[model samples]
Target: MASPLRRHAKLWIPLAFIAAAAVAVWFVAVPAESDGDPDYRDPTLPVAERVADLLDRMTIEEKAGQMTQVAVDAVQGDAVAERGIGSLLNGGSDALHDTPEDWAAMIDGRQEQALDTRLGIPLIYGLDAVHGNASLPGATIFPHNIGLGAAGDPDLTERAAQITAAETRVAGVHWTFSPCLCVVRDSRWGRTYESFGEDPELVSQMATAVTGYQGEDLSADTSVLATAKHYVGDGGTAYGTSETEDYLLDQGVAELSEAELRRLHLAPFEAAVDAGVGSVMVSYSSNDLGDGPIKAHADSYLITDVLKGELGFDGIVLSDWQGVDQISLDYAESVRTAINAGIDMVMVPFEYERFIDTLLDEVEAGHIGTDRIDDAVDRILTKKFELGLFEDPYADTGNADLVGSPEHRAVAREAAAASQVLLQNDGDLLPLTGEESLYIAGSGADALGRQLGGWSGAWQGTVEGVGEGTTVLEGIQEAAPGADVEFSEDASAPVVDRDVGIVVVAEDPYAEGVGDAGAGDHDMRLSGVDAAAVDTVCGAMDCAVIVLSGRPIEIGADRLDAIDALVAAWLPGSEGTGVADPLFGVTPYTGTLPVTWPARVSDEPVNVGDPDYDPLFAYGSGIQT
Candidate 1:
């Protein structure tokens, strides 16, 4: 194979499109305030000026409120208006209302509460629309980041982000906590699927998501705030060091020299900052660069000195869910340490009121200074102003119909097709003609939740009514309209001489620490049932095995020898037809391996640059049809 990066360069968005999509809204215009409204409320004033004016007029309680973010479910009636809460987020829970209209209505009601405040500052709503409007059932679910990394097309990534932004904005969501830029070093990390690849360059290249989400003008109707998350080094943590219960590496420690930390984990964040991302979310992980392991939330050197001072990131430094609480046993110290470390806003979630009162006490007691509070509020208000929330606080229901529209699904289908990496194509077995009598087996063949993996309509991806989309079976049937397509859930039926056999072996849907392989009995291999299905089908006839998983699963040498062909179909989200496209020659296989596929489960940490690197399929190895 030729250089994967150079081959992918041809598919990048045209230079004209890049310019048109540039984040020019990062710099707002400065003009004289209009006569009618206050200077802070006037749309004509510069964002910095408006932020300063608002900061001056805000009471201490209001400023504290601006620095606090709580979950939507925790708030009671009129709590937002009464307490002057700054922002609300849906933290991996079901939507308050199912339809886009209802979602928008709910958020608009909350917006009215914020607008009724003394200063009339609008509230910014956020959600984990990491892959599409994931909280919404009827939104188009694009392939996860690992799949996009295999697809290796930044232009496609940008387009997907654009669609996600448009769909999320229709439901009155002003912000999305997405574009996870972690350079995954250990495959055992549960959030491996959330990263682009194990390489810094690839993760940096995918930062085009920020541009796609923000667009040229953040004030544009389609735009939503993009957060570059798990700041610093969440991906480079050592195994078994996780402080989180029942996890091997989710929130573990990155014990490395400062040079190694900068080289391995800092590049993607630098690229995100250069992309003019709206905010940066601090990681729950800790890092030990010579001194000792210090939580990123409490590490002033990493947060303030490095991310803000060195990278020149003026955007809000937001904390993860209860991220500050992990810094110390004492809640007040945890709050004080995180705030003083330059975290602009805290995701207090349930304990928001306590957070507000505690923050007020800290400021009153001189534990935290007024200047820091003002600075945090300044960043928070600047983003709110940039999002044009002051001018238009309500949701625009014009694009509500586009939430799960066929047009967006078409794009997702194309992405799913492009992301299929053909690793083993012995005897040239793939690109099956439509005329072949096909027998499809295994659970992933018809399972939508299996294809979507995690972070779908819920925190963990689910199979039931995760909106509407094609499954592998449906896609195959559609691709071969006239061909006889038969299916068996486990290949339990006696096999006849079918022209071809395709078995889709899938990992169970999971997210975060629970997905970590080393934490439990998860050996990173195919389940016994899936393995038996593969053997039963391949033993009787020619077969192609599609491993549907978040990361590479150990297939073993015997399983590889049995199958005529193997494809890594890393969690293709809602568009299973994309998986069928390349198999049927509708789209050629161009995706390369994003991570090294280990020959055995024992080769756990194998990577491209390692001295003893030996893999069943090396990184960047993918067969072109």
Candidate 2:
């Protein structure tokens, strides 16, 4: 008889041969079409000729319409077809459905309407897939960039990006707003987790890797387009200032000098552009360079002169949602300034009609020239041609099963496993046995709404009436089937008497900067009722604390020490169950810290580029079994 290992190898030998034969047969039977044409490079073609060859073939309204992007709820099939809206985006709270099939169907229906247009320019669908296609159900959610920074592996970062791209395309989305290259200088900023690391070099390198993984050749591959976003200094915004007075989380103003800004923040974008990124999204944050915050949107110097000319960027430059509105207090003036500044696409996500009217009126009134419109249109058309949307305007709905398929789930599972950092493990208490009676506490443990975080199912991160998601509680229950389990929010559940207790603590879901910084929102440190909850739970029984958050918070070393084990599971999306693999001994805890944990609130506003830098935990710091 063969040894067990030998037997396993012997069994796979025959199967491997069959797999190879099958692949060869499949490729031979279904050879891909060869549109073997020499590279066509013509820059001198008139914009009218280019758009007309594309547009003359298109009806009157279709040519005028491909320029607009509307929200999913606001658009009808007729409007999408007649107006020639070339793109659709799912903003905050917009979801096709909870399942992958539903998502594919939703996109297929939209694409069908788009093909009905005269020119049949395939509608480009986009979403903020910021952290692992967070909008799609069952899409793997990795730890935000801040956590990845602590892990400090460029190879791992690239793998995460590849997984994100694959899964996003699986969901029928071709464009992803990701790899935010902002070098976060302040933790108080809401979008801190969106950045890879605080170091400009690190952010640049990681951003380039992510862009590469998303693929530069969209024409031949099903890979999605990667966008390096919030172009300029959004992370260096001064505290207490925001673009809108009603929400502290909206676009704010950066306070860096031009030299510092370029040296620290702008460096990553340059790297992204060089990597052949498909698009660049302008930041809403105001800069002091020449004009001001709003001017950055339409500033010819920055958008045209700097980004396009100096940096040699050739991709689409899109504004943030309704970001063009800030160009001026006057609606028409705002449209004119932004267009003249160099915006190629307007995400007039809401009220697109007004934007269209304003742009046309401005041109007729001489406030904005037709040449400027032609320039913007030319850039937009060039990108569409490059993306090969002109030839193939439809997605492969026959492969609809690809959405959230097993392959995607496997990648997401790996990311989820890699992203969790074992912050503390006293007495080596982790890898809880399946037989152990686990008592779970905190709102995050059983709540899917809390686990999904901001920009999911809702614009403002509100989870109410938002539909369904897998919770940490469900995950633990599934991992330890038939094991005694109990949950409580008040810390008074009888399950505390169980053999082991797990307390899952999380911040109220929020996006941008809406979550308060001082009192009500969240403090880096475990304080107020949260601290009280921890203290109460720990005092009642032996326990481990798991933090589910977008950013690391300052927790007293003593408090962290008191818990038997501590895990940083940064916003693990619908697959909260994936977290159980590490918790229940199925997978070892291997994720390292992606960002430093602050020992105190005063330690914050710490930048990796700071001269006097000292951190509670160093970047790339993590504990593993």
Q: 1 in model 2: Cα distance from truth in Å?
A: 99
For residues 264-313, write the lDDT of model 2, one tens digit per residue.
88899998988888788988877775445544586677789889999998
lDDT of model 1 at residue 36?
Answer: 72
In candidate 1, what are the lDDT values of residues 223-322, reduced to their tens digit? Answer: 9999998897999987753355644587788989999899889999999999999999999899999888999999899888999999999999999998
Instruction: List where candidate 1 sits over 4 angstroms from the true fold.
Output: 1-36, 241-247
After superposition on all C-alphas, the RMSD of every candidate to the true structure, in Å, is 15.2, 16.9
- What's each prediction's TM-score? 0.93, 0.81
